[model samples]
Target: MLKSDKLERLELYKDRNTQVFLNKFLSEEISELEPVYDPKVGYHYPIVEAIVGSVQDAEAFLNRLYNAGILERRLYDKIIYCPKCGSANVSVRYCCAYCKSFDIQRSALIEHVKCGYMDVEENYKKGNKLVCPKCHEELKKPDVDYRRAGTWCTCKDCKKSFDIPVVAHFCRDCHTAFTFEDAVIKDVYAYTLREDAKEEAARGWVIIAPIRDFLLENGFEVESPAFLKGKSGANHMFDIVAYEGK
Candidate 1:
């Protein structure tokens, strides 16, 4: 742990003027900690911990890094194993749980398409599935062979253009089946903030948009941070400037 070094550094910052030093240290260290963001934090805990200072500081730093565009975060599919079998073997049936059959499917052209019934004219393409309703089946998807068919299907389940073959994963849990892409994933560029990650401390946690809105809502003239020559001659921008008020 870098506790000793940090505490020693803290000692140097004991004087009232230490705030400036702290700012410098934070900015400098962030750049050095550049390896923590990718492929999950499971790999480099030491480096992340040292750069982050403390757990709380690490979290705050991560958030600031996100805003600065040094790193990005996005949602992904909630992949889990079937509790009953503990086997990775799985498929969305009807729109529910991973079933062992293929009596249901969803066509992804318009929107929802799981129900076997309903004849809607769809100029759909191949490889689309929707969640099933009745048995709570997860929509079935097409394989390479199915995509080659170039068939368009309008599903009555979701009223979307998705093509299905048979029963997909049926949710034995909630009985609600559907197709989805895990959310957006955060993408961070190493070079984006590498040089100045440490310098970002002055910007603080609050994002510019919200802070700007706060100023507007409360009726204050606000503008960009005044640029000043930092300790190392780095030109810097403050997070904000607002009129003093109640």
Candidate 2:
């Protein structure tokens, strides 16, 4: 599509929260471009617009869009040619993307097979040439050109690419099993930690009775075993160790 058409479609994003995000991008309040959320999931469309803005709006927007598969990315306006087909008709590309060059001479670069960085680096710095498995092009060893700064390895064989990357966020507590986004929701409930013991909770955290009482009043089935006796200066004995529904 034409650039005018693309910008116009962005204008039609239904959620006002999204509009605010986009407006911020236009105004430079945000450097990385990201979709606020998907209207289908994060919230119902035509959000009347927050009269008094809340952080929940932003949080919900990101969580919902992340669940909805709306991509978050850094946006740029610059010339981009496909490193794959060598076509200049590229519609989308990431910052510092290493594209496979179709040229026979540029194939000397080793593009990491996975993320596709072709800008080449120390991973294979010992070598000066690569055989493009795709186009069968061999490129000369890249010499540092300060103007050409991107983290990508050019693969001579596939003429493919890989990214020079960094791990964005990691929780030492959560371990590698979960993503940075996964812990975002649990963070919302963090204040529950301040409550004293003798409460039921999730993920091994302490939960209190008043919060449980509210849930019960709201029609939640808050069950506890009647037999466990509370001992002074000991962990609150849970009537039920963990939930296993009837």
Best by lDDT: 1
Each prediction's Cα lDDT score?
A: 0.40, 0.34
Each prediction's number of clashing residue pairs: 53, 32
Q: Which run of 10 residues does model 1 get worst, by summed lDDT?
A: 182-191
Over 1-246, each residue of candidate 2 has an lDDT whose tens digit, in order, gives 233232223222334554454444344454443223331222222221342255455456544433333323232222222232323232221221233233222213345443344443343444665443444444344342112244444445455555442112222322222222332221111011111111111212123334455656666665443234456644443433333334
Please give, for residues 53-130, the per-residue lDDT of candidate 1 as tens digits. Answer: 664565555554444343344432334333343332334544312332333343333222444432322333233643
- TM-score for each predicted model, relative to the true structure: 0.23, 0.18
For candidate 1, the C-alpha RMSD (Å) to the true structure equals 18.1
